[model samples]
Target: MPEIRNFCIIAHIDHGKSTLADRLLERTGAITEREMQEQILDDMDLERERGITIKSHAIKMDYERPNGEKVIFNLIDTPGHVDFAYEVSRALKACEGALLVVDAAQGVEAQTISTLYQAIDQDLEIVPVINKIDLPGADIEGVSQQIVDLIGCDHKDILQVSGKTGDGVDLLLEAVYELIPGPGREKDKPLKALIFDSIFNTYRGSIVYVRVMEGTLHKGEGIRFMATDKEYDAEEIGYLKLEKMKTDKLEAGEVGYVIGSVKSLQDARVGDTLTTTKNPAKEPIPGYQEVKPMVFSGIYPTDSDDFEDLRSALEKLQLNDASLSYQPETSKALGFGFRAGFLGLLHMEIVQERLDREFDIDIITTVPNVEYEVHKMEKSEVVKKIVDNPSEMPDPGKVEQVYEPYIKASIITPSEYIGPIMNLCQERRGNYINQLHMQSNRVEITYELPMAEVVFDFYDRLKSSTRGYASLDYEFLEYRKGDLVRLDILLNGDPVDALSSITHRDKAYDLGRKLCGKLKELIPQQQFEVAIQAAIGSRVIARDTIRAMRKDVTAKCYGGDISRKRKLLEKQKEGKKRMKNVGSVEVPQEAFLAVLSMDDD
Candidate 1:
């Protein structure tokens, strides 16, 4: 264990974390110069195209010191986005130290502060490294000072490096071995390993990535999940060098994958403890919390026959992303679908895009929402129930109070756009908390806001208001009592279940009116006139009509008698009245999605 080191890399999005990983890999000879690629740690095409890491990965590398001593380094690369906080936490738990990379040009953004707190909470040894020194206007001294002010680190200990040019990376690796202590060696103890992450395969059911905490784990051994108590036979064990490399045994303080005869992904849950069946550990490790979904929406297939295919795709997606949660749902207007939950807006968008591009399925999504706590009067007493769907919300008279989720949002931007940014946040019902004057004439403002408001295009609007000069990060706060109302959209007096939403009562009328007008434009004109109305309970606040198609009966008459034209017009009017009584309005898929495209605050 003295020669082995476990560490992870954490940074803000697009702050040279992946580039640094590639440079370190090249410097250590993990991959030769011919095999190197930009952002090699990001394996997904979506991640590569966007230049961000969405998942955490573990790799084993062999590095030699100047004294010709060999050291084994287990490096885990983590996601920098706020949506993947759970992923970041899992990676942090497996490491003894972290490399906190900061961009020299853009010093101490919102996510950098957020990730710093997480690493501090884990009590891991943090080594600050200022990256991207080759860029124009790179301020190494300014960033180093910011690190000292924010994290209370000594300015002299901060290292400066350029990830693009592979400068000072060798010195950074040597500092890692000298500064961070290796894991303690253990023996004569029961086998205990922590499953930090896992993925599914068709031939081999579940491949669980683990970090051994106590004893040895070998191939062809019987193991049991400490949480679920389910048993499995380990089929293979190996290292994760961006690929599965087979090995016979994995000892304490080593990170590797364990292929077992497990049927489903749920059987091998992330954060669960794994132990050998014959000699199990005395107790499971602490800090195994389940991930709760922050955003919820309905996903319906465009073709009703493809509902089964959508379900299969969701199940497969859940196998890889354990944070995703879903259940079957039926909508009156959308037919059969599922109500899916995600970590945040980005997580939700990525899942939707993958379903379309990877699975070849076309789907329509409702406006995103967060869970609400509804308190209703039951038997002369108040009863509370958590409601995620607006259609499931209770009537206003039956409830005593309604609580909506809120988040503490942090924004870092140049001082020039502070006025417009504050105005935008206030328009969305944000409550100002405090502000701090940062270096480089920048400001960091904190606000308390409704999660619903931010879930639908809040980030986009913020960027537009600030001209893309601002960065934002947020964390979930507690639920607070809110004046909430469920707004329902009705087509020809029939309520559409999929178009219902929960909003603040003060802004409900304006939002309802806007939705009614948008739906009027999206729904095609029909033979019979269709009335679109937005209602709150029994009160209709807004209404619009799609005019019926008009026919030129007189044109077809040519030089015929006037009486013939009158007779044709009367017959047509009678036919329209009959059709209006029996026909139903067909709302297009775009009509349901149009609610999400609205930019009005």
Candidate 2:
């Protein structure tokens, strides 16, 4: 316990957190030069494809000091995105300290500050390291001052290292041991361990990653999960190295894994406490909260027959990703589907991509939406309803008011682009909050923006406006009263339920016009002219016309028979009237997906 040290790495996305982990593994001789891989801790194929860490990984490394003393290092790599903040919280609880990695050229970004505050709140010792110093644009002096000014850490103590070149990495390992203390000792106490993370394997069942706080856990011991109170025999106990290395037992103040023959992933939950069945701990560990999904969208298979297969694929995927939540829903236009909730936009995209690539399933995802509160008045009583889908909104006459979710968004960038960012936020219905100057040149702007405004292409536009120098982070604030109305799209004369959306009253006309124009371009022309209109309640805000495909019936006629051509045209017009009464527009799948790309103008 005296020589064992546990710590995690936290950083903003693309700040080289994964690269630093690889360098640390190399320095400790955990993997030889031959076994080295880029982003070694990011295990998912999707993660590698997207070049981001979506999940947390823990590995044990053995390091030796200059005094010929051996020390055990338990390294946990956490996700840098705000969507996985819950996972970061769990990882921080299992470790004594964290390494806050910052890019030398970029200084501190949005996620950097957000994660740093989380670590500070957790009371974890933070070691600030400036990475990517080998780049020509790397500004070591500027970044060091930023750390001192923003985080209030000593500037002289900050470690300057290049994760790419492996420069100054050996000193970082030494600093970890000197700065981070070992786990507290309680060998005589009853069995107590905190489950920080878990995974499901087809052959071995559930492999739970745990940090032993007290007592010992041995192989073949019956243990109970504090959250579920379900007992399972620990089939194997071991340390989490590059692979699971079997051990006879794990003692107090060590981080490792337990392979219990748990049948389901829910049984081995993260943030749950584990204790021996014979002598259970008096209470469960603190700070265990169930994750609630922040965004909701409908997912439907391209082929309705694959609904069952989609359900099965979702079941298997959820076994590993417990944060994903879904329930069966049917759309009139899309047929059978499921309304799934996710943590953020990236999370929603990742899940959709995995379902497509891994499961070999073609899916059509509707436009993402947030949960809204609808207040309806019936006589003298008021009924509050939570609506996740816009099509499910009550009639305009019955609804008294509507409230939409808002977020406290933080944007960190160079001071030059502050004006454009402010204009963009205001256009998206963002209310001004406050701004602060960090380290002189960098600025942090706060705004209260509706969640609906930030969901689609907001980040992309911000990057474009700032020349990719700005980063945004947001948290859900309470719902507020909104003067919003439901915008419905009508094809010919009938409304399309899937194309309905909730928008602010002021922007309703412009958004409706855009959506109607987009649909007109996407929907193929039918035998009869199609009238595409965007409506709000009983009024039409925008309209577009798709001309019917014309056929020159008198083109083959000859011999200067002008009167004969006119008679043929008359017959053709009469036939077209009959076809127009019975024809229906055949909208392609692209029409449904086009709504996803609609942005705030």
Candidate 3:
């Protein structure tokens, strides 16, 4: 049997993971010159534009060794955002080894360290590739030292290659073939294949990506999900010779696609196992970890009629990514907003971007939200309330405690920006972890902070302080009891209905006051003056005044410009039509975004 090698490229955001995959595909002749697309591994338009791999994409290529031996290589690429780290982990589990791409200029980033530790835990052989060697500021030696100090890897084995220039890429390939051993096959073992990632195909149904570990899987083979025990006859079992190109069968130790009698996407659950009943492997593949969404928000359309379309779009997205959990929810005030669950804030943003850009839906997104715990003093119990609004927290005084998620963060920036970052962290109630210095004049500072504290504005604040030179990454550390309260904002002296949420008391004070001030700015002067008050229950926090409009007269029309007078009336009607009437006040999209804007406060 021919030897098969399966590996994944893991890197921090913008660390050249996809770029290296591009050159590897080119050198392997898996893609013809004309077939090449920049970052082909990033299949989605959003992925291409964002310059991040949002989904786990795979491509097969052929490489000829120095001894003229042709080998088949299957490579998987994954997103670098912490939100989709679960997706990345699934991709890593499917591979026997990995290519750890670290930017020579950036050195060891938080994500780099995080993913490297995951790779180590998987016990997969890692080939550290210091990419972007062609860049002017690239420091191969310095980054190699980081690999040693942080990842505990040997400095000599670290391969320095430019994924862009294709310099020294061949050495990295050799290391893959030699050090990363070919996947082993147990011929006598039962059929056990892991579904690392899968997608819906119009013609073929749910095409489960199967990497055969034991026995061979043929076309029309009967397989069942080991976890769900849902069995189906495999209609078309094939290996990826190249994307969309399929062969007849996937032999043991090879990665391929299984597109047969799949009727629904629910059948092809990622991280599930597919095995033959007669000869199933004693144990399923052992590397998969469940990916739970970490961030959430509602997605609603402008036109009430488009509600169904929005729901359908979400369904299709969930068909491919089961990790994205959402349930249909309706509000008399807001109409409809999906209680969307995400792996992280970035994941939430990416989903919204895909919905707006790809689905072509005009959506009004609520603020990115985190899960909150609501305590009931009467019952002496706490209810986890991920979706918080004024209606749910009606009995605010009865609550004793609320727990929110917290994260361990690591920030990398210039030395000059350290003080500002430290101050910012301290202001957010951060417990300092440690700081390390690198040879290229960058510092790695660590902290433990409430996830809510770092949810928004922190990135912007960090960038503002550092002049856009800082990069931050964090992972959920744990959830703890916090001195939190629900801040509710009332516009026009009445609660703005939907603008109520929970936060730490200290955070709520500043955030509530700031939002009330912004709401005043957002609420245009109506026929009568409006009062914007931010509060927690009956206790008023901050107040802002929006005085009634001053002047409302039009310029006198000239004799020749009667048409101009008619045009003015038409413009007024159109503006009125666009403005939303809440009671007697008018609100626009800007008003909605203003309350939710990152820096509106």
Q: Per-candidate RMSD vs. true structure?
A: 2.1, 2.0, 6.2
**Range of the 10 consecutive residues with the lowest summed lDDT in candidate 3:** 382-391
Each candidate structure's TM-score, on Cα atoms with residue i matched to residue i, is: 0.95, 0.95, 0.89
**Candidate 3's residue-wise lDDT over 1-601, tens digit each?**
5577889888888888888888898888877889888987777888888788877877777888999898778897777877777667777777889888889887777677777778788888888888998899988887888777766777888888998889988988888889887887775567878787888866767888877778777677678887666888877776675556656666677888887667777767788888876666677777555666666666678777899999999988887777788887775446876778887777777788889877898988766667766666655665555443334664568776667788889898878889999999998799999998865677999999988777656787888888977888787877788877767777655665556666667677788778877777766677446677888888988888777554332466656667787787677655544542444565556766765663632
The alpha-carbon lDDT assigned to residue 116 of candidate 2 equals 82
Per-residue alpha-carbon lDDT of model 1 for 1-601, expressed as tens digits? 3388999988888999999999889888888777788999887899988888887888888899999999999998889999998778878888889998999998888887888788889898999999999999898888888888887889888989999998999999998998877876684578888888888888889899998988998899999998889999888999988668999988888899999868888889888899999899989977787789999999999999999999999999998888899999999999999999999999999999999989999999998999999999998999999999999999878979999999999999989989998998898899999999876678999999999999999999988888887999999999999999999999888999999999999999999899988988899899888899999998999999988898887787788688999999999889888988998998887888788898584
Candidate 1: residue pairs that collide: none
RMSD value for candidate 2 = 2.0
Candidate 2 residues lying further than 4 Å off, grouped into runs, are 378-380, 554-570, 599-601
| TM-score sort, best first | 2, 1, 3
The parts of candidate 1 lying over 4 Å away from their true place are 379-381, 556-571
What is the clash count for each candidate, in the order shown? 0, 0, 6
Q: Name the TM-score of candidate 2.
A: 0.95
lDDT by residue (413-483, candidate 2, tens digit) is 99999999999999999999999998849999999999988887788999999999999999888999999
Write down the lDDT of every candidate, Cα atoms only.
0.90, 0.90, 0.76
> Pairing residues by index, what is the TM-score of model 1?
0.95
